[model samples]
Target: MASNRPAESTSFAPSGTQTIGFASRTDEGPWEEWNPTEDSVRPVRGRHRVTKQRGGGLARSSTVLGVGVMAAVGAGGMATAQTGKPPVSISLPDLSSVTDSAKALIGEEQASAPKGSATVLSTAGVSTTEAAAGTKNAGEALRARIMQQAESQQDRIAAEAAKAAEAAAAKKAAAAAAKAQDAARTKAAAEKKAAEAEARKKAEAARLAELAKQFALPTSSYTLTSRFGDAGAMWSSGYHTGLDFAAPTGTLIKAVHSGTITQAGWAGSYGYRTVLTLDDGTELWFCHQSSISVTVGQKVSTGDVIGRVGATGNVTGPHLHLEVHPNGGATGIDPMAWLQSKGLNP
Candidate 1:
């Protein structure tokens, strides 16, 4: 858009012929002479040259502080990084007392920035030495706790095993004791039985000896002329029925066994005879006796004189006829065999 208000004009005064003019159509035809030339349009050199401005002290100091903040984070200081507090709000560490990388970073920051001024970034990042010490302490405490637990568990297991072993040993000892006790009881019982058997055997032997002392023979100092069971036709039954003891007349004849005299008088064909009946109903016949000393029904002991030997019956010489009737049987056992059976080989 064109402005319609007053055009701005400059008031000027000319020195000699200075004037302002407008070009007509004739003058506008070829104005090559008015074109600019190189030398005439060239820029001119001036005396003044641009210089750099001085920067503010605050800006440089701020830059140095920023560097210090980053250095605190990398310097391994406890007041920075892992402290969790704002870096500027954290306590400023004593540079002289700081150790390892923290001391080095503090020195650099002192040279670059201001004295006694430092930033805390992260303690985990910057406080290398203290952080490692804390980690090691924690690991050691944990290891000690684990070792204690393991030892306690081992002790408990060992105690249990020892208790079980003791129990087993006690059980074994009890069994052994019981076995020994049973063995002793059994041995005692066997010994008692043997002792009783020996006592009974000795008692039986004493009784048999006493019985042997009580038995006796009918007569002594007599010659055996005939034995029982000898074939003969002179007596009844056609056999020698009694043992014949050849002796002189009036030789003593005693009771062969303990008995009572049942007959003490003359018997037909036997002359003066005596019959001794024993306790078991066995009769002992003493025939051809000259006389009888024991009366009838008189009790006699073994080796008691009851009669005298004489040849009064159907005999060829003076002798004693002794016959045995077992249980009152007509036949009797051989006297020699009977005597041998009683442990007397007659």
Candidate 2:
């Protein structure tokens, strides 16, 4: 054994001062594997290396020591340059956070490891390497992305369906309410029409009952001969202008109601005619009478016999022609309707 020691030793650091060392993010494993004399340690960042030595072992040792100091001070990163074994990368945890396992490794290296030696890295498998590298297969990445997208799409579709269901329900309720409103309006209209008709009927009945006590027929023994507005050329007017009553030539023709006799005598085509005037200036003419009992301006009461029926002047037969001249107008009205207006149905 030729002095198992270095030929020389050197350091760039000042004399008798502690060189700075660095803490790394990776561990180098066991401590007994480093031997700069046989293995090359390449500089990681700047220019320096602890290369294998064939001559001047002491000087090589001194250089390796210098490189080691740089490595300890975190001179970027360091690794053995020779092959056969992979280049070893070495680091340390933060001194404040060092675990028991890391502390044991450091203690073992300081107590048993020789000078100019490095720590060797050992791994369980490729899977462990891959885990440290944060690598995943293509299939696994794709599967995770697909699962996230599927979940998102499903949530969106479910939300849309819920909104559609709610809208349909609201529409159905509105339609039902509209239909109910229409039905109510129809029912109310029908009820209003029925009520109005009933009221009119009652009013008419009451009027007729009152008029029954105030008026009487002109001739009770006569038969209906013609109606007003009858289309015939039997008179000067194409349409008959009066209501007619047929009876014996000598039948009694009474005054229709209490009134003054304005004229009583033969009056041309209205031969043996008599004109009665009411309080409101309405005129009543009785024509085709056999004889007249009252003179002009003579007052007469209702049901008083004022003339006898005859066919003296423009008459097809013995009949009394009664016409209504409202306000003594030249044009007479439909006698039947005029009588009904007074609550007398004839």
Candidate 3:
């Protein structure tokens, strides 16, 4: 078995007093107790020589302690494997002491290092600070760009909306203008139609007025007793075929127009009658007259006294019956209408 005690020193030492430097034994003094210290010991040479180190020798001591701990853990593991035994727990020294020693060594190493190496470390720190500032500036720039883009998009949208509104307003205005134009055209057409109608009416009046100058009433101071187509038992036909003008006896009758007398002194039921033929071959008949003043085949002008009004054959009072025949036909038309055509109201 290996002993845990330290091995005894093999160095030689004198147990009692000895002669100094080959002197006589009578000159020797009494011997005293001897104590050994570091100052009293002499340094060894070769590989065992002890050299002084800086940092109060803590660096070397700490290095030896770390190596010894690693060796001890490795030996323990080997023993456990070889002997088939459980691993023993090892008690480690305080880590704080090792840490302080390592700090002290680092401080001495930096102090002895060159200026260029220290500059490199300082430059690295500055670069780190610059990189952080650059990151922050980049973030701010990006935010600003995003805001500007958003504002531009919003402005574009607003412009488009305004453009749309303007387009709608223009369209509405165009439609309103078109509607007004249509209304104006309609009003103009109506006014044109009315003007044309009025012009035609005036032209007709002028034509009738010219005809009135060439025609005259057959008798005056008379009242209309009957009209053509009047139904009565006093006439031979079922309806009256001529217009009647009631007046006092001896009322002078006049020629209706420039015409030649065709018949006078009527016979039968007609007490007095006269027939006049115009240039157009239209015949005018004056019946129930009191007297006849014009002769047959005699030419007369308008307003010439032709006869007088009186009660004649088949007559109930002094009245003149007038008839008109176009182209001397057997049938006659209404004298009132024929007179109105000559522009004479009566």
Candidate 4:
């Protein structure tokens, strides 16, 4: 380290005794101090020349040498601090040595640099601009990829929704078809039942018409004055056992069916009477008649005139009482019902 102490100074004698000499040694010969004069000094041979100034100051070459030494010392100190290494010893250089060393260092730096390194450093701004452009391109590519993926997802969802809707519609259509089929089946069954009923009714009507051809009404132009089983004081059996037909006294009575006249004539309260016996053993009796036109044991056909209506046998007016007996039983049955069985409405 350099000290902070001041440098030693030498004082020269005053004006008139200025001549002084110093003993010095030189490469050429033994040194001798001599007063310097322009005539006594020799001209330097190199490009640089040393000359004494009017103010007795150092030469410009010496000043340049001092500045070079300071610069080198400063640079060495800075390098030591940055590298964290022990400081290296530096020797002060003579004027000629400093110049030669600076030239050599500059040459070495030029040789160590890589090829085209200077050109690359000079265009550094261009590289920064290109890097920014590359980043922008990459961002655009990423955004495009994201958009494509979103679109694909949307399409998938839409397809699924449409498929579901179509399935629901198909199911609804199937249900409607099933309901319509059931209705059609029910209607067909109802129509079949109605047709069967109509057919049965027609068959019954045909049967009744055929029976009407074989049977006949016993009388005409007469009103039913009394029905069998009627309760009245005029009847001997307490309840009437025969049907009565009322009309003018001359109303003719007919045989209900083809039968034999088994008995004819008056019998007590029955003023005039006639009995008809059918081949099936069913008997028909006519009473309260004005007169009898049939005789016993005589065969008569249906619709034959057998008697006339008259007020007799404890009757209130002119009317014929008719009775029916199935298989000739003593107790007679309702004549009106028997007439209906033979297809007679009267």
Candidate 5:
């Protein structure tokens, strides 16, 4: 360590009255005083010029020299073990140039750097940046995977719901169809029964109407001598062919029921015959009449006087031969039972 001690001062008189003092690191005690008379400041040969005590160049140069010596000592220590030669060292008097260049590099980095996430990555180290990028990528991938799985699950659930809805709809449709079919069947059966009942009623009405048109005995005084199925030698078929009404020939032959006279004339076997046809296609034959007051196609009312009783055809004398034909067929029915069907006992 160098001692910070003040040395002896020297005085110099440059003009008649101007005075200057100087001090140094080394001093001998015999101080000198002199007058310096010079026109300009100058340097001595082989030495640097000394100026006033301003502490400008000398201080700066000394600082540079001390840094250089320290760099040299450190380099020599670093090189001594392997090689006898010392490593080279260079020192700058002012480090502002290198620091300015470093600042320029930082500015360029700032100017050309990316913004947002990329800007953060440039300042960070390699391991830190890589780890951050990997973490971000992993997070994004995991989110994407979760979204895809969610979409798949949603699609599966939607498909299942659709299938269930379709099944329910089909089941409802089937049940409705079955119910409709049952209703239709029941309706059809009821209609069939009603139609059958109506048809039977119509048939019965028509049968009664036909029976009313037949020539039955007006009074119960007549008797049945010739039945429809009695075997007889007088008939052409060797059987009794007509229903007989054995009344006196002159007895009033009232109209059997409401009808039109289809024929009223002298027929060969059934002389003075009268055929009356009812509306429902039944025919009444009155034969062996002494007189016929009705003509063909003549309309008549029930109980009206149509003819007089007579034995005009192949029959017993002074009797009426009467027969009933359904739709004008050859065969005849029993007069007694046929008249009874119309609520009349004969």
Candidate 6:
């Protein structure tokens, strides 16, 4: 069988005055205590050496250093936590911070983010600078549109008003021209009528002067017995209204002027009278004629025989009673004065 006892009396000394001996349980009595010399202890330094400590070792020191580094990192992370700052930030594509400079470069990465991230960015609140720019641009566009419309409307209205004014002026001018033409026409017509009236008046005056020269006395030899308007018992209207020429019967009675014979026959109380009418409305009566020589409407020359002289028109003697009337009135004027106006002395 194999023994399991220890060997006896192996001694090793460390440093001064301290010695340790090793023995088995069956070793003899009277052990010796030895002292170590001064040359036994030496400083040693090398790689891959095992150092011995009393209780604590290198594992404890390494654990203490790791705990201190973790505490410092936790404090730094806590300090920036309010601002959402990360610890040890790196340039990893998916985990990068949202910086102002990096946000402009998000086009390529926008598709990789969540589906609604692009929508959130697009609908974000506008800054004061962006809002002011948009307002200025919109106001300029609105003002341009309004000004264009107002200018177009103003031009149209002005053109219409000008056209209306021109039409009114044309109408007024036409009315004035028509009035002038009408006035000229009226003046011409009035002048024409006045000229015709003057010519007719001159011709009538010439004809009247010629007729006055042709009239002559009714008898060559006679005596004026009664004058015109002699109030005596020989008149029916209370007056002798005509001149009585007392002449012998069967004497050649001549027509006073170139006139038509209106009557050459016997009248009541006037035996064989003849009435002659001239163109100037004068009437001559030769009454109590012995014989008639002309009929009605027979034209006779001056001193032409119309009837033989006798008594006529309420006469009493067998004598020629010659009377003259200017306008066939019942009253008569003095034959002597009327003959003198015709350049004849009765």
Model 3 ranges with Cα > 4 A deviation? 1-165, 267-271
Q: Quote each prediction's TM-score.
A: 0.40, 0.56, 0.54, 0.48, 0.38, 0.37
lDDT on C-alpha atoms for all candidate structures: 0.72, 0.72, 0.79, 0.73, 0.68, 0.66
Tens digit of lDDT per residue, candidate 1, span 195-282?
A: 9999987886676566657767677788998999898888778888888888889899988778899888888777788989999898
Q: Write the per-residue lDDT of candidate 3 for residues 1-346, one digit (tens) a residue.
A: 8879888763234344554688635444454557888877865332232343765745554454454345435554321235568767676554443555555554665576565553111212432235446667877999999999999999999999999999999999999999999999999999999999999888878988998899999888999989999998878888899999999999999999998999999666767889999999999999988899989899999899998998988888899999999999999999999999898999
Error of 1 at 187 (Å): 26
Highest TM-score: give the candidate number: 2
Per-model clash counts, in order, read 12, 6, 0, 1, 2, 3
lDDT, candidate 6, 240-316, per-residue tens: 65666677777788887888888878877667888988878788887778789999989999989887766554677
TM-score comparison, 1 vs 4, better candidate = 4
Name the TM-score of candidate 3.
0.54
At residue 25, what lDDT does model 1 achieve? Answer: 39
lDDT winner, 2 or 6: 2
Ranking by TM-score: 2, 3, 4, 1, 5, 6
- The local lDDT score (0 to 100) that residue 211 gets in candidate 5 is 63
TM-score, cand. 1: 0.40
Best by lDDT: 3
What is the lDDT, from 0 to 100, of the residue 335 in candidate 4?
Answer: 86
lDDT of 4 at 178: 96
The ten-residue window of minimal lDDT in model 3 covers 119-128
Which prediction has more favorable lDDT, 2 or 3?
3
Residue 140 of model 5: what lDDT? 99
Q: What's model 2's lDDT at 273?
A: 89
